[model samples]
Target: MIKFFRKIRQKLLSENKFSKYLIYAIGEIILVMIGILLALQVNNWNEYRKQGQKEIVNLKAIKNDLQHDLNTEFIPGISYYSKKNKDLSRLRDFYLNKEIIPRDSLLKYFRNNWGEWHIILNKGAFENLKSTGIDIISNDSLRTKISSLYSNGYPEIENRVNIVKQFYDNEFGPILYDNIILYDSTHSHDDFDDLKNRKQIGNRIIQHYYLRTWLFERSELVKSKVELLIGDIDKEIERLDK
Candidate 1:
């Protein structure tokens, strides 16, 4: 094709057909421009396809991370904390209402349930997404929701956990340590010898009840946010599959 065009241009030049040669030259330029444009269009399409594939891969990774959080963190965390709350309620009734529950039973429940519960979110994919640029997600709504889940939702839950932890460490823990005879397997006893002291600490336990309730509600909120995130992930995955 190049040789053919060159021969035509040379023949036109040799015949002193400047007008036709100029027209041929202009046509050649247009063809070259069209070829460049087509090449650019194909390159653009390839880039778009690559980006789409990247988005799908990221979405799948994010889905895996979210599922891990739900299974290994959120769901189990909720259950564990719910049981702790119930145990606390039972102890509260034992103390506040002067319920006739056995001392060993109450102490066992207290020993088992008392501790700081932390929510370890699976934010590996999320952190990577943020570092790589969230715009890669493509879907504006989904991207925003993902961002909110990490930035707002998870942090809110953590803040609640911290609040409860601080109260436990600074107030509740020391009080309980001083007042209650913590059950040890090596030196187990069924006697409620410190019942008077335990009753004295009941006022402090009642004071900390609000923190427990707040933490439980915040855990529920985290679960709700996680569910919403999972739903968005499912929708995005379905979209990608299609």
Candidate 2:
């Protein structure tokens, strides 16, 4: 193509067709400019198409991750309820009925560990979303559903956390430590209820037992919220498929 253009220029100059040559040169320049512009436009279109595909894949992965977390962590996490109930039953049998102190410790490690772990799915997932900025151009329905899911779900989770926090601060913390102390000390199964009736022991037991009950209920509430979030993701995935 360059050779062709050069030959044309040489002929034009040799023939001394100055005005005609100027018009031809201008036309060639315009054609070249248009071709370059078209190539650039196609390149941009290809890049955008690739980005769109990536966004869809990322969204699907995020949806799956949320679903797995709901099933694995949220529900089983609340299984502490059944565990705690069993412990309580054993305690009742030993102290109230058998009048024998069991040697094993009876505490739900789940609720205790729950207070230690800081869980906010939004943090990591939202970071991924923000990094991609794909949600900016997502389908309107998908965007709306995502927004509603986070909004509706996060607040409930936060409320549950707050309730649990209050339980921990007012009831669980001191009582658990006191219970540990009693466990280590000379207190026996015979002193179970009466120990609570004592000025020092009674206050701690009342708080501990009350918080234990509340902890189980709060676990259920969190589980419900997580289930809702899973449903929200399912709806969004349906939208994506469409």
Maximum-lDDT candidate: 1
Q: Give, for candidate 2, the lowest lDDT window spanning 10 residues.
A: 109-118
Error of 1 at 67 (Å): 2.1
In the range 1-101, model 2's lDDT, one tens digit per residue, is: 99998999999999999998999999999999999999999999898777666766766666676676566655655565456545544444443444444
Candidate 1 ranges with C-alpha deviation above 4 Å: 14-23, 98-104, 184-200, 238-242
The sequence of per-residue lDDT tens digits that candidate 1 reaches over residues 48-143 is 888888888888888898888889887887787777777777777777675656644767756865676777777888888878888999888899
Estimated TM-score per prediction? 0.82, 0.51
TM-score for predicted model 1 compared with the true structure: 0.82
Clash count list over all predictions: 0, 1
lDDT of each: 0.78, 0.58
